[model samples]
Target: MTLFSPLHLREVTLPNRIGISPMCMYASQDGQVSDFHVAHLGRFALGGAGLVIAEATAVHPHGRISPFDTGLWSDEQVPGWRRVTALVAASGSVPGVQLGHAGRRAAVREPWRAGAPLDETDAAAGFAPWPLVAPSALPAGPGHAMPAELTARQIAHSVQDWHDAAVRAVSAGFRFIELHGAHGYLLHSFLSPVSNRRTDRYGGSAENRLRYPLEVVAAVRDAIGDGIPLSFRVSAVDGAEGGSGIEETVHIARRLAAAGVDLIDTSSGGITTDRSTDTRIRRGFAFHADFSRRIRDEAGVPTATVGLVVDAEQAERLLDHGDADMVLLGRQVLDDPNWPHHARIALGDDSHDSWDVRYGSALGPRARTLARLTASGETPLTRFSP
Candidate 1:
């Protein structure tokens, strides 16, 4: 199928294969989305994204990566999300959100400020860092605060939190729900042995590691019900040495599918905060295609691949060659929200007919005007040419 082809997942049908990957904007206040999110997320739908997944929203207050990250932990957050989902749905695009708990990665500064651990200098600015928690008591890195290991009772509580957040996500009008289990987040921490040093049913062996994430899956599925599609993003490989590998992640994907996860959004790395111990995959074009293909084939589940998917031809090639069932773009779309519309032109839709009528109606004539100008050997700079 082509990149513009529809992908059916349970009861949801994405109009095309171009999905906007969840990228955190770090612009909220106390986990409440402001107008920035409405305009930020709404434009992608208008720009022709088939599936628009919101940023990694914390499932619990302590799960936030930064104090400014958005959240679904409280009912008050629902109205803001509802505004965004309604705008996206009006364009026939599937509105989705990636729910996550940052775990040891919680309480870091915004990436622009170097993602350093939040300290009292920020508390003076009224953004006090909170305690971080994880599967183990290990500190995330050199400058990060030591996290408290999650207790058995706390683990049970965390599962309920995910369930409650899923309920909130539905109330917020999100049609597709994706669990952010990748990039050393809470669920990924439990999956990789490097971070999960616990000895209970939640750690050690592979099966033990998968327990908590699977429990979350069941809880979210029950909350969202059978009709709504559920997706899980997995790291597929850990960044640190001796951490979980593709073999382990593939096994995890299989179990996730059986536990009601409808799709595997394949990604990798970020299990460690230290750049020294980091073994992240190279940022090549469509970096996660190989991982996605393997997870799709071996695990017997549909997959969406992300990372450096910059252009339409490259994205279409990924689907054409069976690299993935769908392609997700993050930085590329941020650079140009109408990248999908441009892609349709690049892939032979010269009429711009599929674009939002507001844009396409004007764009089509402009394209013809440009074409005519080009036919007359007139470039914008040609008037000054010798």
Candidate 2:
């Protein structure tokens, strides 16, 4: 299939193979999406992305990566997300969201603020840090505080929280729901041997480590029903010493597929806070393609690959070569919201037929005029050139 092909997952059919990868904007207030979200996300839909997955939204307040991250923990957050989904749907794109819990990575400042853990000086300035939780009481890195180990009751409560958030996501008009099981978050913390040293069922063995995440997945699937597409984002490799490798991740993907997950959004690393200490795979173009291809082939699951997927031909090649079923773009789409439509033209559909009527009606004529100028051996910047 080509990059412009449709992807059918459960009852939803994405208009094209290009998807907008979830990237936290960190622009919310009290976990509510602001005008920035509507404008920012709506533009991607309007720009013609087949699937538009919003940022990593927390399932609970304490799970937020930063205080400003959006959340779906309460009924009050539903309507705000519904606005996003409605606009995206109206633009002919499927609206989706990634549900996440930052775990020990929570209660931190935004990436621009150094992404460090908050301390007393920050609390005095009104951004107080909350108590972090994980499978074991461990700090994410050197300067981060050691999080409290989650008790059995708390783990059960967290599962219910994920279910409740999934219910809210359905109410918010999302057709697809993705669980953020990567990036050294609560789920990843439990999965990685480097981070999880617990003696409980939620740790120790690989099967035991998969326990909590699978329970949450099953619960979320039941909450959202069978009609919605469920995706799980996994760090294909933990990129650190004693972390889960590709083989371990394949087993995890198989379990996730069995638990009713429709797609595996393959990503890697982020299990360690110290970049220097990370033994991550090389950061080449389409870096996660090999991992995604393996998971899709061996585990028998559809997979999405992201990382340096910056162009139309490159995205097409990923799908064309069977490396992934879908190609997800992060910064590339941010650089050009209309990358999908532009890609359509670059891939030989130059009629601009895929663009929205409002923009195409004007741009269609502009494109012709430029082509005519070039044919006449005339250049718009020729007068200015030395």
Model 1 backbone overlap count? 0
- What local distance difference test score does each model get? 0.93, 0.93
Per-residue accuracy of model 1 over 296-355 as CA lDDT, tens digit each: 999999999999999889989999898899999999999999998889989988878878
Per residue, candidate 2 scores C-alpha lDDT tens digits across 1-386 of 39999999999999999999999998998899899999999999999999999999999999999999999999999999999999999999999999999998999989998998998988998889999999999888888888999998999999999999999999999999999999999999988998899998888999999999999999999999989999999999999987889999999999999999999999998887977678988889999999999999999999999999988999899898999999999999999999999999999988878888999989999999999999998898888889
Could you tell me how far off, in angstroms, the CA of residue 132 lies in candidate 2 after the best superposition? 0.4
Task: Estimate the overall C-alpha local distance difference test score of candidate 2.
Answer: 0.93
TM-score of each: 0.98, 0.98
User: Which 10-residue window of candidate 2 scores lowest in summed lDDT?
Assistant: 271-280
User: Which pairs of residues clash in candidate 1, taking residues 3 or more apart in a chain or in different chains?
Assistant: none
- The root-mean-square deviation over C-alpha atoms between each candidate and the true structure, in angstroms, is 1.1, 1.2
